[model samples]
Target: MTRFSGFRVLKEALTGHNGWAPLWRNPAPKPAYDFVIIGGGGHGLATAYTLAKTFGQANVAVLEKGWIGGGNVGRNTTIIRSNYLLPGNQPFYELSMKLWENLEQDTNFNSMVSQRGIINLIHSDAQRDAYRRRGNAMMLSGAGARLLDVDQLRQMVPFLNYDNARFPIRGALMQSRAGTARHDGVAWGYARGADSRGVDIIQNCEVTGFRVEGGKVQGVETTRGFIGAGKVGVAVAGHSSQVMAKAGLRLPIESHALQAFVSEGLKPTIPGVITFGAGHFYVSQSDKGGLVFGGDIDGYNSYAQRGNLPVVEDVAEGGMALMPMIGRARLLRSWGGIVDMSMDGSPIIDRTPIDGLYFNGGWNYGGFKATPAAGHVFAHLLATDTPHETATAFRFDRFNRGYVIDEKGVGATPNLH
Candidate 1:
């Protein structure tokens, strides 16, 4: 079947020499900067903005291969929740939630962050126990989370099928403030705001290599030219490994493809994001009334955005089970985005072995929600040269120390947290 992709339209929108807006009207002049950030995704752009905002470092430039937000920011399902199942991640994600709460007002950008709520459907007794512990842990950490039974799930979404489904809803762990945002709004807002602050947002400038001198990262060799910087940050998410290896650093992250699909605009069948614990299936209704959903990771190491058919089938089947009414609904869009799955499932926001180089990769799929907080925390690390207390556990050394923050306690799905 042919696909109806919002992503395809986006790729076309960012084309024609002058990528993204304002890139053509007035371009930036090439010069050495105080800080040069690679990858203009939500994380990278936000990091640069935070750096300048907090430290008054306006001599910063954000380099992008495509236009800003052309990467995962354009492709994410936009689920923002702190319903983490582990201690290491719950607190940090809670911090992210607070940041998300104030981001729109602060940035003067309509990120479209809706905190309506998110529900994780528990299909089995084991899933119930796991969610119970997760909900309790979240509350203890001062984040709101509640466990709802099958009856409660039905009450919340009356359309949900409680019986005769592949994964029956036994219960759910619900966080009232967990929700979504307009993915592109995040990147554009940050880009426009950062540019206004005298930060050079060099689009279509891909970093092909890194320049290191005396064991310190000096700058980046990009497609445009060699951009100099006192400190270089590799904020590249999906291409984190590829970008770092150019600087002779190896991160314990593997790239994988994650895809999301949207059904033709419906009557907003889903109030907020809903995830089935038994499978990696989740769905949410966009403001446009499209039923946006995604399944689990493609389950292999690959940079390919095209996914295997099994996942697509599984997601569709799960959607039908959740709301049988959508069984015949038209599938409007299908697209994939690559993710940098760190070993621990948590982000590695720390100073790598290389000096003057900061790494903010390995976000898994939490890039959208964590953008504001990622910026705040990463700036804290960059400006003060101290790992923010909240993001301390997400250090890069945790993998070697065996201190993995495996939130689902699943060694395999490091991206779940």
Candidate 2:
């Protein structure tokens, strides 16, 4: 691994920039390992990185069906924040925020973590109070938050439709430390970090079935081969059901397609991440001047990574309602990623009924933001066989115990979540 720094950049520039090495290796999987992570996306790669770097687990491998960064890890809008109102979600996300803050230094890779800020606009008085409460919850969790009045919001984002006849923007819940990171860079960084610590990152290696004997997972059958492992961790988002079914375990998760859009490059418009108070639309300006945005999931169960027109039109309406000026901007391209919408909208990171199998999925729309903490906590569980303190509420048996962490209060309906 080549260490990247200003001196290296200068040296490379002087030497025709040919001294750079690949960020991560394309390693072949071993026949057996201490641990195997079934996915190569951000969460899986981060899990491998944490297991090797943090937990001192050297015999680890990350098996990805496709290439790295080909999943939701690179498909998200790249917003990172911790402004939840639920006890189960607030602290976990706050931990992720702190991890994001120092991720570049920790990984020795430039993930392009920009802590610009994020503002969730408040529309009605009730919404204002709700945002205030949410902001208070964020503060209580040691995540920064502030309540900004309409005037303050106007000063920050004057392009918004402040006084619309329907759904007026009264205020906003602001998180100063919240922002975005480069999606693909995050995956590459984690992959590199994990590989440097002797974790094999095997791409194009699909897990076909679980090798369970006597009710405990011995390993997994993959396209590459039947790789043996002491423990197997499943972090395949959206495909949780299909993957778990191979092991005779069913999850309380539904797959839904969530679309994200990027507009034609424009001037520096969106100051930071901003969400409409009345709708699910959220927009942020990328470093390359493109306005990246997204909205609610497609409101239907789907395994496809493409969405329908109704969602596009609905998201456009939300965007226009928030900032009418963007109506003139042309949409450059759009894509969708399948999300594992859990019954209660919160993620699950817990040990399964099977002895050597662990589960981590049902992230809904929060997967990208929760990558670091999810990986750390999931790795903690895998290495120590105990749940992280902040993630104690994300139990697999919570639904059966009638203790669902319904963060959005949308009840048991996965589509609504």
Candidate 3:
């Protein structure tokens, strides 16, 4: 592959733009590979890239049922932050934020990562106190946080409904380095990087069943053919349970559809991402001038990629409450992506009971932001057969051991999380 550079781009532009080539090669899957990863989303592709580049494991294959970035990787609001509170999650997510800071340089692709900052609005005295504690936790974790007063918030975002009759915006918890990134660009960059490292990314190859024998997995039965593998890792997002069921493993996870919406193009209004603490709504202005936002999940188990209208109404209500001016902006489009809501509102990345089979799922709507670190740690576990330092708490046995990392304090409620 030719290295992409500004000079090359200028040369191609002057030469009638005919010097460009495909970012990645289209290669067929071999009969066997050293490692086989199911799913072609951001995490899976990142895992493949890390496995090859960091661990020196190039004989890998990533099997995607659909095209790359067709899943949650592309179907998110494109927010990235690590303002977590729990030790189990804070360090892991902080690592992801660090990786995100250097993602474009590492992948040699412009992911459009914008550290424009984010704010979680506080609506009441109690909420302000909670946010203060959360901000302290974030700062302690080295993820940078600040508790902004009402006057400070006014100076930052004067357009918010500060004087609402109810749920009035009092203040906010600010993460100056938290921001957003281009979702599709991230997936494409990782896929290209992995492909360049000789990892076969096979699209339209769905895994039908796992080839297991005597408590060990040998390979997988797929739509194309039976592909043998020395090790197998599962990273299917919302379909985690269904995919793992084929391997006879049940997970403490629920599949729910999370809806996201975009507004028609407008002038740059939102300076950065903002979340309504009184509600589940979060919004950010995209590079194209459209307002990208989303709210709570559909509140039910579903494998569908589309969402219902009630969520649309609920999200609209929250957005209107946060910034009434958005009501006048015409709604352009909306879509849904299935999320693997873990029982304890956290993710799980560990080896299954079956030897040679690993699992990485239950991201609970945080999948996109956690892509790079998820891939790096999962690759570390897969390559070394041990948990990574930052990810030791994301083990599969945590739920059984009552070590749940309930960041939202929602007890065993996937929908609430």
TM-score, every prediction? 0.91, 0.99, 0.99
Residues 304-411 of candidate 3 have per-residue lDDT tens digits of 889999989988998988899998999899999999999989999999999999999999989999999999999999999999999999998998799999989989
In model 3, the clashing pairs are none
Q: What would the per-residue lDDT of candidate 1 be over residues 187-291, giving only the tens digit for each residue?
A: 877776677777888888888987888888878888888888888877888889998888788888889888889889978577888886566678899999998
lDDT of 2 by residue, 346-397 (tens): 9999999889999999999889999999999999999999999999999988
The lDDT per prediction is 0.81, 0.92, 0.93
Note the residue pairs that clash in candidate 1. Answer: none
Q: Which prediction has the highest lDDT against the true structure?
A: 3
Which of 1 and 3 is ahead in lDDT? 3
Residue 210 in candidate 2 has what lDDT? 93
Residue 80 shift from truth in candidate 1, angstroms: 0.5
List residue ranges in candidate 2 displaced over 4 A.
none
Pairs that clash in candidate 2: none
